[model samples]
Target: MSRIWDRMSLNFLSEDISVKSMKRSKQKTNVLLISAVCLSLSACGEFSYKRGASANDFQQEKKSCATQHKNDADVDACLANSGWIVVSADKPLFAEATTTDNKMPVQMTSDDKVIAEKPVDPLELIAVGSWWKTGAAPNALIADSEQCVTELGEAHQTRNNMSLVTRGLVGCMSAKGWFALKK
Candidate 1:
């Protein structure tokens, strides 16, 4: 009787240990699954994945023509000569031509300051706009010269006969040479 009782006790303890081990394994699996799901979600949320260098954000160290050259006017002239257009002033932005035929619009302030200018290909500008509107980047409108160019092109192509100021950005981009008015 003593032997049989000992065997039965041992069996019961073994079964309990097995059940605990199984539960532990299941919990570990659940944890691993949750971790994987969270990682995937985080990756999906990331914008601007695998993007190349952005010319829109010009760094003084890497992109500035000032130190190597002399004066803002000289730098501006150098950029203009290279076919880079000043797309924005507040941030000092510029764009290069994707093709030779396209010309950047000249920017003239009310105070008669010449800011910046460059030549830009029309089709390339349009493509860039479309890419911005539906690209993997975080925000499209932040550097969207293409949108302005496309609108201007459409206005002109439709023969809307709008004023140069109102003709949309594409037409402005299409004009012969763009310039940034100096302040």
Candidate 2:
């Protein structure tokens, strides 16, 4: 009888331990789920891009482009150039991109072969208040602003507001068909 009781007690203890373990596992899962939700929400509002334009102007430009028989790319280019930017929602503008790339290219790879890194989409970059420039090689994006400084020439380096220099670089790149923000 005593031996039977001992075995029964052992079984009960094992069951208790398993129940506690299950509870802990569930708690951990809940914590992970909450963490994942918060992480996703943080990335939500970071994708809005805005230019110095009004909603009315954006609508008008979009309507005008609709009237034209231009391709989708041409319409987007017209809107972008006309100071309209793609926004995630009708949310208020947070900030304008004022960054300048002044770093000079230190070295180049020996091979002329393109590395084929994913071309960072310009709309996405603009949404995040960033910039992209065409690289010297075909299908290549200049990795950083050192090339911009070089392309702008030494005369631009002396400017009080480097943002203007950045604007100039962007204008130059846009004029050359490099500013097409992929829809």
Candidate 3:
């Protein structure tokens, strides 16, 4: 079974406060009820999973944060203070990062400083948005990206050969005049 079920089973076993004395049918009902409650409570968690700024940015930020924070909370705090924002569809904590036209200027605040003049590149701007199909091959995308990044003279690469590109790489591809096309 999955970790969720395992954890729920453990919880049910541990909360054997009244289970031992109950009849078998009553125990099954109790287990189901407890499981439902546990699932519901878990689903109600306030904290949402976060995707850090960009591929390049996250790597850099994580390297910076690693020295200071051994705990996940501390690391998250450090990243937040450093201006990293969360990008998740299941739970949205803030507004989308970019406007319709990425090249247009938008205000980006970092370390209490407002950057109003910098233009958001199409890739960076659309990183949280959409363009191409989601089922693209990793190798093809990486090959295309390498060609584009080299052309733009930007140094951004995937860490651990992961599926997604760094935000900087997206911008690099855009700079090289490549838009992610749908198949």
Candidate 4:
């Protein structure tokens, strides 16, 4: 217990803040948080890409979501350039993407390989007991769900935000294309 506690520190909670500093922090935090959320959501989205198989064949796979963007502004610019319609007062914006390469930023592995699946965000599920409520989750995919929860726990042992952890779990399950079936 001491060893575990030794690795943990809550210094941020103790920091003093000036009114000006607090305002700046709030502004910066909001921007960063929104950007982070946008990127995270995009990671789970279906994007248009070359569709094929055979490992190297590499066409469209369900995991090929365009999640990586250099910045929020960059994404906006790309969207505008593509004229993909940002928001319409009328009509749903989402459609099954057909064009190859949605033109958004592409996340790559350390080996420079394009990441097909959006990596799970443990921070999104830091406090969830399991990926899904028992009996609500699909039995066939529970193994992956366990792996997801364990990964979240191990990755952020000190972090304990229930909502974030749950979101992370959802992201993990989404990345793996695991859908919880209705009981």
Every model: Cα RMSD to truth: 17.9, 16.1, 17.2, 23.1
TM-score of each: 0.25, 0.28, 0.26, 0.21
lDDT of 1 by residue, 23-47 (tens): 9999999999999967764553321
Indicate the worst ten consecutive residues by lDDT in candidate 3.
Answer: 125-134
Per-residue accuracy of model 3 over 1-183 as CA lDDT, tens digit each: 599999998899877845665667797898999999677545644332224445677777778898889997788678667756433325543223244654665566675675466765534422232223345664656677677557645545444442344556655555444443211
**Candidate with better lDDT, 1 vs 2:** 2
Candidates 2 and 4 compared by TM-score, better number = 2
Off by over 4 Å in 1: 45-183
Clashes of each: 20, 1, 1, 12
Quick one: ranking by lDDT, best first?
A: 3, 2, 4, 1
Candidate 3 error regions (>4 Å)? 1-135, 160-168, 172-183
Worst 10 residues of 4 by lDDT: 57-66
| Candidate 3 lDDT (Cα, 0 to 1) | 0.54
- Residue 13, model 4: lDDT of 38
Candidate 4: Cα lDDT at 106? 60
Q: For model 2, what is the error of residue 115's alpha carbon versus the real structure, in angstroms, after optimal superposition?
A: 59
Per-residue accuracy of model 4 over 24-89 as CA lDDT, tens digit each: 999999999999978854564422212132433222221132254556455544543442223322
**Candidate lDDT values, in order:** 0.45, 0.52, 0.54, 0.45
Tens digit per residue, CA lDDT, model 2, 1-183: 999999999999999999999999999999999998678545544232355656566667788986784686677667666655554433433332234557566576777564554532222222223334444553343422345547765543413222233334544455454443322
The better candidate by TM-score, 1 or 4, is 1
